[model samples]
Target: MFPTLDIQQPRPFDLVGSTILIAGNAAGFEGTLSITVSEGHDEVTGIASVGSLGLRQFQASIYIPDATAFQLTRIFVTIADDTGNENGPSVVIPVLFGPRILAGYSGWQPYTVRAGDTLTGIAQSQYGNADFQPIADANQNTLANPDLIFPGQILRIPRNDI
Candidate 1:
């Protein structure tokens, strides 16, 4: 492609960690290329260089900790040629970044229970609060006991800000 903005990673509903790989190529453009991911009040931006082959292959990263979880994050990619011809401000695609699992709605996020992870611990680690009842109630379909959870099981955590 002559001039293209392609997203090669973090596909829709794909489980991601604190650091999600934001990769793509903006070939045929020079100058600077910036890839930005923003959700709510949190955003991560990165820059990559154009190679000698007249291709700008970017393999940058965006860290969202627990901020962008359960939200429709906007992917903004832009490129400018050496002569200052700008290609974007273009919104490439919208992707969901979650902690461990992705729920169907933005009001909730999923977390894969790890070994020795309790609901209260999950709640504390995720929301910075140890109240696990909200998590247990939200994940009734997936978890039968708030006191016990197994690894590799997906548990939903409410996105309610406390």
Candidate 2:
């Protein structure tokens, strides 16, 4: 037999402007569990379950972004058996900064032609960088080609510096 656990978060979260509710479940055996969120080397937050759930289901939620942005590089969940054994898995959630205009720019900012930006040249004129690849990578599925952007498409411009 195999131990099982499942965790999920709603997608298309807003950056610097949304709240996320984290929830999940576990089976087989359990005494306590720990949940953690991180961004690269930064530890965002964590919580531990004090109650018991033997062969039953468990659920909890952690509020993301109380006052600031909920920038996350990874999310991890761990379950420990009563025998002092632990098992679980982690999930990575990509982070996008924001649509904030750079600085001192009156008109819309410039953007490069990423992999899927068919209108990349147009974006370049607006953003000034030809390396629009990050845009494509960020919105991989939606952007089909470098020159095939549809109307009302929102693209995440990579920050100039981390």
Candidate 3:
């Protein structure tokens, strides 16, 4: 019996907003699978259903109602079988939570860096007032040095309503 799960969306170390769209392939039972997003303390869980066939595509939109409860910015997304085995076949993805950076945010806009671009300049152009911390925080996986951004490098500009 095929018993493997693969997450194709929101790759590892990605930044997720309040609601995340998780899509992947499940090679196992047609029953439901457990999808959990946890930050070591608080967690959100959902169930995804696989196709009747042994191997099928599955998608689930999980909403983190209380985003403020998580202490750590990094969260884990795990998909496992319904057998409740502690060591069963599962896929765990570690991603940065975005709401912690930009309050009430659900997504980001992509900005391509130019030759004469700086985090401060980008912040002024994107967010006004030159507060680049939010931009840097939202793209921890991409930007290693806030001051050293290369041309053609894409950055995620977090959308903040609050």
Candidate 4:
């Protein structure tokens, strides 16, 4: 029987760090599973051991290249059968890739939006420049419009030192 996989953490559109923590349940397979992260341009794949007697939980960390980060708004994280088949059973989780999760800066600072706040303003205040692309890219899941953030909305300000 084909394996079944389900991603539980970092739900759709969540901002991910350099080292992503993927947790989920798997069934119908044993030995190992494949974890792939792709931006439709480039992809990284890793392997995780799975002992499938029945449904069981699994966790794996897949490292992403900085060049791949924020290049696209959304990336797909997939856990699939490792039989080298493109049509194998798998689960794809779409998430927003953050740029601030570079090698050195692997974390993000949370910023609460307030009235009259703009991406440029926030960028200038936080990054000392008017380049808001990074902020917009990191929070694309939350802020659809770069100029349309509302109060009480939380944004992830990537801790980019690189």
Deviating ranges (above 4 Å) for candidate 4: 1-3, 65-73, 83-86, 100-105
Pick the lDDT winner: 3
Per residue, candidate 1 scores C-alpha lDDT tens digits across 104-157 of 324567678889988878878986878776566555445566787899988766
If both were scored by lDDT, which would come out higher, candidate 1 or candidate 2?
1
lDDT of 1 at 7: 56
Task: Give the lowest summed-lDDT range of ten residues in model 3.
Answer: 24-33
User: lDDT, candidate 4, residue 127?
Assistant: 81
How large is the C-alpha RMSD of every model relative to the true structure?
9.0, 8.2, 2.0, 2.9
Best by TM-score: 3
TM-score order of candidates, best first? 3, 4, 1, 2
Q: What is the lDDT of residue 160 in candidate 1?
A: 40
Clash count, one per candidate: 0, 13, 0, 0
Question: Model 2, stretches more than 4 Å misplaced?
Answer: 10-18, 27-31, 48-51, 55-57, 64-162
Query: How far is 122's C-alpha from truth in model 4 (Å)?
Result: 1.1
* Alpha-carbon lDDT, every model: 0.55, 0.42, 0.83, 0.76
Q: In candidate 4, what are the lDDT values of residues 1-162, reduced to their tens digit?
A: 634777687688777776778887776355578888887777888998777676778887888766444456578888886766788788888986665333355567899999999999998998888988877877776777897888998888877656
Candidate 2 RMSD to the correct structure: 8.2
